[model samples]
Target: MWSGPRNLSTAMMYSFAGRGDCAVWDEPFYAAYLKATGIAHPMADQVISAGIADPARVANACLGAIPDGKPLFYQKHMTLHMIAGFDRSFMAGLTNVFLIRHPARVIASYSKKREAPTLADIGFVQQAELFDQVADRLGAAPLVVDSADIRATPRETLGRLCAALGIPFAEGMLRWPAGPKPYDGPWAPHWYNAVHASTGFDEPEGPLPTLPDAYRALSDRALSYYERLAALRL
Candidate 1:
């Protein structure tokens, strides 16, 4: 699945990790992204040093074989982390799923830790690009799951997602043990504190994130892309 930051991607990763038949990978492309862009994200250097730094190598790892010989490999990826130079052919054999959330909620949640985020930083345009690419290559629109829909009805949403991917809906996907697992990315400490604290999807909370004046334009642009994809959601 591909998603932007603060989009409940980690929780979704945990959900999939709960399944015995699936092996989960967390942001395999991140180290390569950090190395190429030199964006000073939290723990950027550590993340790059801790994992495979070459995008091609990482792509090969993701595409070549299923590590541990699992039948299904659930890779949790960040759209922005794919970066400009990365080969997208790895996606051809993969069941690409796009996970989306409201722009206001995303911006509000993201800005709490980072300052003055741009549209590129939040990843909606990249997501739309990837979505279009996958759809064009496969001659079919890929699956899209809205975070709100997942939080509202996890079983139904996940069941539909599993059916689309041609997998059984495992009861284990509804919850998992709290705290980090073996598959967590090196940057987990910086990005996954809240998710690491939860065993299951938390009920959607709050008065939706309040969009600041500076983020309004970016949010508007993101909402356009988000709605376009959301219109096709299962």
Candidate 2:
């Protein structure tokens, strides 16, 4: 699956990991992205040191057969992590799923950790571009899931996703153990605190926060892209 940061990607990872037939990988390309771009994320040094920095190698691994002989390899990817030079051809080998959230909510939640986040940092534009590329290659619309829909009805939405992916729906996907998971990336401490605290999808909070004037345009752009994909969501 491909998604932006803070979009329940980790929670989805936990969900898939609960399945006996699936093995999960968390942001395998993130370390390569940080190394190539020199972006100073919260734990840049630690993450890079722990991962293989070559994008080619990482892409190959993503395209390789499932690891550990599992029937499914669920790779959680971040759209922004695909820097300008990263190869995208490997995407044809996998079933791509886009996870989106309201841009205003994404911006508001993201700003609490990183200030002055640009549209690139939020990743909606990159996500839309990737969605187009994958759709063009496959000659069919890919699956999309809104985070709000997952919160409201995880079982139904996830079942639809499983059906789209040609997999069986397991009730075990609805909840998971709390705290750190073995498949979490090293940077989880900085980004996954909220998800780690939960055993399942939390109830939808009220309305989204209003974006400040400084981010109004950026949020609007993101929302346009989000709505485009959301229209095709399951």
Candidate 3:
């Protein structure tokens, strides 16, 4: 699954990992992206040290055999991490699903974690680009699932997603033991506290959060890209 930060990507990863048949990977390209861009993040040094900084090696590993010989590999990817110079060829060999939230929500949530996010920092533009790349490669649009829909009606939403991916929906996907998993990246402490405290998807969100004017403007810039994929969501 491809998504921006502050989306429900981690919860979704936990959901899939709850299915015993699947092996989950969390943000494989993050270190490589940080190393290449030299961007300072909350845990930049530790994340780079703990992760594979070589994009080529990361790509190769992504296409390698599933860990533990599992029947399914669910890789949780951050679209923004696929910056320039990273190879996207491995993506063609796997199912690509885009997970999106409203830009206003993304901005509001993301700003709390990393202040003053730009368009690139939130991953909407990169997500759209990746979606188009996959769609063009397959001669059709790949699967798109909204975080809101997943929160509101997880069983039905995930059931549809599983069917599209040619997999059976396991009831286990709806819940998991609260706390971080072994697969979480080193940066989890910085970004995953809320998810770690949850056992499953939360109730459907209330009205969108109010944002400062600067953030509201940022959301406006990302809205089009989000809407493009959202319109095609399962």
Q: Point to the candidate with the largest lDDT.
A: 3
In order, the Cα lDDT scores of the candidates are: 0.89, 0.89, 0.94
Q: What is the lDDT of candidate 3?
A: 0.94
Clashes of each: 0, 0, 0
Worst 10 residues of 1 by lDDT: 204-213
Residue-level lDDT of model 2, residues 1-234, one tens digit each, is: 878877888888999999888988999998999999887788899999998799999999998878889999999999998878888988888889999988888888888878888888988999999999998988998889998999998999999989988999998899898999977889888888899999998897688787789877778878889999999999
Off by over 4 Å in 1: none
Pitting candidate 1 against candidate 3, the one with the higher lDDT is 3
> Model 1, residue 119: what's the lDDT?
91
Candidate 2: lDDT of 99?
Answer: 94
> How well does model 2 score by local distance difference test?
0.89
With a 3 Å backbone cut-off (N, CA, C), the pairs that clash in candidate 2 are: none
What does the lDDT read for residue 82 in candidate 1? 76
